[model samples]
Target: MTQDAQKDSSTYWKKSRVELRAAGFDPDRTAKTTAVVTIASAWTNAHRCNNRVRGIADLLVELLAERGGQGLVVGAPAVSDALTQGTPTAGYSLVSRDVVADCFEIGHYAHHGDAMIVISGCDKTGAAALMPLARTNAFGLVLYPGTSSPGKVSFEPWAAKGTNLTIMDYAEGRAAQEAGRISAAELVELERNVMPGSGTCGAMFTANTMSTTAEAIGMMLPRGASHPADYDAASDIHADVRAQARASVEALYRLMEAGIRPRDIMTLRAFENAITTVYAMGGSTNMYLHLLAIARAAEVPLTIERIQEIGERVPLISNLQPHGPYAMTSLHAIGGVPVVMKELLRAGLLHGDVMTVTGRTLAENLAATPTLEEIGKQDIVRPVGQPVAPANNHISVLRGNIAPESCVLKLSGKTLEKGEFRGTARVFDSEADTMKAIRAGEIKPGTVIVVRNVGPVGGPGMPEMVMLTIQLQGRGLGEDVALITDGRFSGVSHGILIGHISPEAARGGPIAAVRDGDTIVIDPGQRTLNVDLSDAEIAKRMAEWRAPDPAGRLRPGSVHDKYVRLVSSAHYGCVV
Candidate 1:
């Protein structure tokens, strides 16, 4: 090893020793075993969260320990148990930042052993755990709890149960209404019929997208991307977890033997590859920010522009979630993320030479796992030469007076108007306000919905305001309504939703200057978001706008606030 590598290894080992001691372990006498840390979202309240945490824990304890010299350490058993029991614990306490911090803490404690495995399958938790794992550069593997299959599980029970029926309910209700007068009981039953079993929603939400992206990036084993809860495959969840943990350890040992650094496994190219998959899968908009955070942790420069540039060439292929008709279970049955990677590689969209945890080039991994005919027939993954959309259709970075640092928009399935639009800017400072306006019929069709104060530094975490788009659609103005936000949208979000407007209102982005009835135009075909105002008008407004006091931000005086401050102060990709 080079002198610097040797020093780095030594420092890491020392840090591990310190952490282990702090965690109530005897550094000198503790068994030299790999430690696997699993982070799950609060379980009981969210069925998918419960199953994922339980499934991963069950898998790790069984698999790694059987490998002879490995020990499993779950980061938050109390939290896991609470989630499984369905009891409300602390609110907002189980955020992704906490999970990531735990992973780092546990990984450091266990670094002296052999390797680390991360088992997570929630939106923030998955991203958080993986980010720190990348930084540890420890031999790491991720086990994603799969989504439940729609065919096998019955949503009837939940539908029969109760709650505020969403747009889907309304859609079904409309059908019912058209047929005849339906009782309240009938409507409740119908809603439950559509949301069966105990799993995360099948759409391409943050959890599912992160899992698929993890597999695409090589942090997960081939064909490890999806397993529906109702399928026999879900029954083997433990086996899957164990296999992943074992493979992770082996991969780590191979890297150590080859004198490969963590950077070798997690590289700039790999980050780009993962981000591209995130776009293609119609993954989470959170990924745009999460990718930036992960890249920072790995000491890579990943900007909004870089992500948009990559998206320009990578088409949205996964016919899942908010953009398409299928769910994650269908994607898994159709060959999962490996198939996606294979196609991307074939299309020359992904860098085939990138190193993976599997100890093989990406090309080799795909070749070894040919898509089964049954799965291929389902079209889970688009063929390399014939993709769902041409390369780079899923995401775009936009720049205008509104977003100086660059903003992002997912372009897949989006129909843009050829001519410029001049409409009054209907500004809503928060998602709640926007929704209230929509429901109250105050928002007219062809309105520019400016959702401000929800950027990275603004929302604090830049939460996706997906409901705004859904509400707009419900109002029969899906195409006519344009959403301009400093926040983001879910991967399932489509149709003229512009997100990640940088230099957010809190930081004086042009979006902050937009008032109700100000003329705003969006020309996606030309890649422009112009407000009909002169430079002087914009400058004067900029001067007059007062940024919100930092104290007013969400999660104020919390760890999230601290993270925001830390990341904003550090290099762009250093959060991990």
Candidate 2:
């Protein structure tokens, strides 16, 4: 690990024990390792979320090889720019979990990998790695590059540095600019500094939300969730970063020694435990998507109905933005996600008997943490009795005439004002059209904006769109207006946003048949979303419906075309 002490100029993987040991590798093993652990990472410069991946991957290689095992890197790419409208990509955006997971699966067999140390720095990459980790069912451990530090940006008085800003601030700035509260110049400056550095945005968005939930589910090490990518040199997060990465590598090695695997930890009970935690944290809707994909790979029987049941029982508890007043950095300041899980476990909300990467039970991990009582008193994570939502079940599945396969709704924003909504359908064929209407002041209150043909098969990777939700909120319509789509949403997004409408428009779902001005009702309290129409009328509409063309105008033999042909519906997790 310290150096390449010896080399076979002709071949790799033919080193003698002496050669390995001369490099300071420790060959004395208490138990034999089956094979080199695969270190999977979607390493790219396209996003800061992937910034720490290479460093961490390198550290893992050294740790694994030093401990009488081998390690190698498998990289994948998922590129999208949050700064753009609806977060469009410059190119090559239709990458799939199947491809990313296949890298690990193929490597698991090709190299006889016995365990895994996977890296997920972005939305799809994280979810992608989870599936292969589950499929391998080996002694696997997941660790994020960690969330990004918040940038100090705002246009309140001048283009002065204000509080921490994430991607959500882009909408806030644009909203302020249009309202005449700030100028276009200020909006431009705010956008420039909104995203400070790499790592997931400093909110409970998809990446960080899944990172936090991964810890709660017992696949990640304690205190590994919300550390900043690059913080002050004196900050605790930067003090011993490599040591932390090495700790996970060691944990995976030990897990392999103990003959433990992902399926053992990601069981039905553990998946339930993770769902309960996601509800408590007001986490991303993507968790629903990724969790399903992981369940299928792990062969766990989890369903939308089952998730709705968990939401009914678990209350939204974490106060992190855009769901509440705090950010992910604050969560780390208060002892990270392990402390949060300890609180949930104390409330009997988590299955404490579940296996973990540390070769200990979930209960044991909590018990080992001496700071639980000390940090349990913080406002970062509220007590169960006083949660973010006044009521329980901030996330649930809606079933009726429109979404018989069920659509999901986010009911946990701190500014949320209603539990139910009724409005006329204002349909749009594409995100660009929907954004144009909202910006032009054409979308009004009492409107259910339906943007169809954006599901996994339709968008051809289900390109996430919290932009519409955020745009409405910018126009002061977060609660007054409602939006439903077959696309995905950014986790930081708030409002009466119903995403992942299953049996997507591309597949002739009822959402494709909806017409403008049709009465669309979304009542989370009743657990239903419906269009007021006779079954015969709805059938007639569907019978004559035609799938819309791809928004990206995908070409044949392209990545998007492949996703369209092979991807599953949002109902079954859009898995391939």
Candidate 3:
């Protein structure tokens, strides 16, 4: 705490008169409450998105000071990254959720501020910030730093270069090299600048997906999802992102005065709106996982089945990618979430009356937001009637012998065109083994890739398999194969992938019983996933199954180590 802030605190208990005057009220009679501003952010520059978090935090400090409120930045744990294919925070020294949970818990218990501005950049941080906000029921606002702009890189033959070559396209680059299409030097060059600067990966990946959900659920202001980190502070709309920081904090101040809390906006009806919005946008599979966690915090009952129920009715209207060809930057061009939500509201898919942080209803926010007519027309966000995927919302809740609790399938991206897949299981206990087999071209066309011992309990953090999925895509075998796991997939993962299976292999689920060459079938039309074996035969096989020895995992004293022992199935949102 600063000396000035300490002095300000001394008088805060008796400052009704002073605050009334500062708020433009007649001090003689007006009773205005002072709002202490707390700034929470994950500000590490390990990624470009983190830079935006830091910048926003600094900007909030300045804005709150101008508003005559004392503010201080609270340090939160940044999800340390090393390798991701194994588990969510596999290679990192810290267990991500444990760190993130503590970050919010500390702030909530400390009562650092009456009103808070949560500044987070990426996927996990959003969930971390969200849970405690709901738990504390504080008057606060969540602001994302925004998606990063696409960096340019060039490869050959497959058009994986320039704005076309996102970091995720590195997998495609590798495939091109092995096919003798691109040279080794070209591959190196593409990897070098695939991510030119900071932002999240250039797809509807976890970061973008969570940010979009935040806006859809009314926890954030409209159109904050797709703005590129704009490190230069210049966004496509309004002014620089710095101005957005100021505006967001100001909104927080106003909401505090109005006595609005996060619980008011994130109601059961609002969760439905969020679920519907996610389906319409072909959002991240991680949504199923994180939304479950957030819903648990908010005391809302939600599950993959309920989510798929919404998906069954809503159409996948946007053509955004890691599944499609467009990026967050493209969404920004046509108008961001406001335009998209407006169209969804027109379809009666979202709760237009849900309240938001800005003290406006969802309908009012969309109505006030200028559309593509003012921003210049674009087709990035398609009409509901003529969507990218009209048959389904690109989300499937599969239940069968394989996943009793239910598994989620994202049929968006390139995976949309595929039908039922029946293939032999090529089981690998870890993502590294799967990646190795993929690089060696040992995987067959009718393969059902199974990576086990990496779910919530075994993986202990349930990492998203971005590298493996992208590698499969690069090999030109994306739709030809099916990957299922107890862990999860990145939003960019397309092509017949199933994840978030309950009773993970480590817990002696059916997945542990499977041997090499066991047949697996995924029928999207029926929303079923099963292995070709009799129930008794499956039972006999599982009777002999055993979890991998945990000698090499995070040590016993570590939080990750503790998680392996206490975390529930992914079916339970992986909560402890």
- The alpha-carbon root-mean-square deviation between model 2 and the true structure, to one decimal in Å, is 5.3
Q: Candidate 1 on 1-576: residue-level lDDT in tens?
A: 333443244334434767768977566543444333222222333444446556555555555455533344545422321132111222122245445546554644544424455665555555665675666565566666655444221244223323212223434343343334455665555554444544444567666777776777777777666655443323444444455555665665565556554467678788788877777777766676667766666677777667767877777777664655566766665566777776677667888888777778888888865654435465556664565666645556666777666666565645454544556788887777776787677877778889888665666555566656656654566678788887766554666777877667766778887788888876655667778877888899888888777764545678566656643411132242
Q: Which residue pairs in candidate 3 have backbone atoms (N, alpha carbon, C) closer than 3 angstroms, thus clashing?
A: 48-198, 87-463, 88-463, 148-199, 153-162, 321-324, 323-413
Of models 2 and 3, which has the larger lDDT?
Answer: 2
Predicted candidate 2 versus true structure: per-residue lDDT over 183-243, tens digit per residue: 7877888777676666777878877877876787788888887887766322333433566
User: For each candidate, what is the lDDT?
Assistant: 0.60, 0.74, 0.72
TM-score of 3: 0.89
lDDT measured at residue 237 in model 2 versus the true structure, 0 to 100: 34
What is the C-alpha lDDT profile of model 3 across 1-576, one tens digit per residue?
432443244244335667646856455432232556667787885655566676677777777767766555777766633235445355332246546756765764464456667776667786666776776666777788766566565434424433634556666677667756678988887777665556666667777788888889988777777777763324332244666677787788778778778889889889899888877788888788778888888788787667777767887877777667677777776677777788888778888888999898888888866654455556677778877877464777888897888888777834434567889999998888888898888997989999888787777677777677777777788878889998778776777789988788888888787778899988888888898999999898887776677786778788777777777777767776
lDDT (Cα, 0-100) at 100 in candidate 3: 71
Q: How close is every model to the real structure, measured as TM-score?
A: 0.80, 0.89, 0.89
Provide the lowest-lDDT 10-residue window in model 1.
81-90
Off by over 4 Å in 3: 1-33, 80-83, 86-95, 153-165, 231-239, 370-377, 391-393, 413-418
Tell me how candidate 2 scores on lDDT: 0.74
In Å, residue 74's CA in model 3 sits off its true spot by: 1.3
TM-score of 1: 0.80
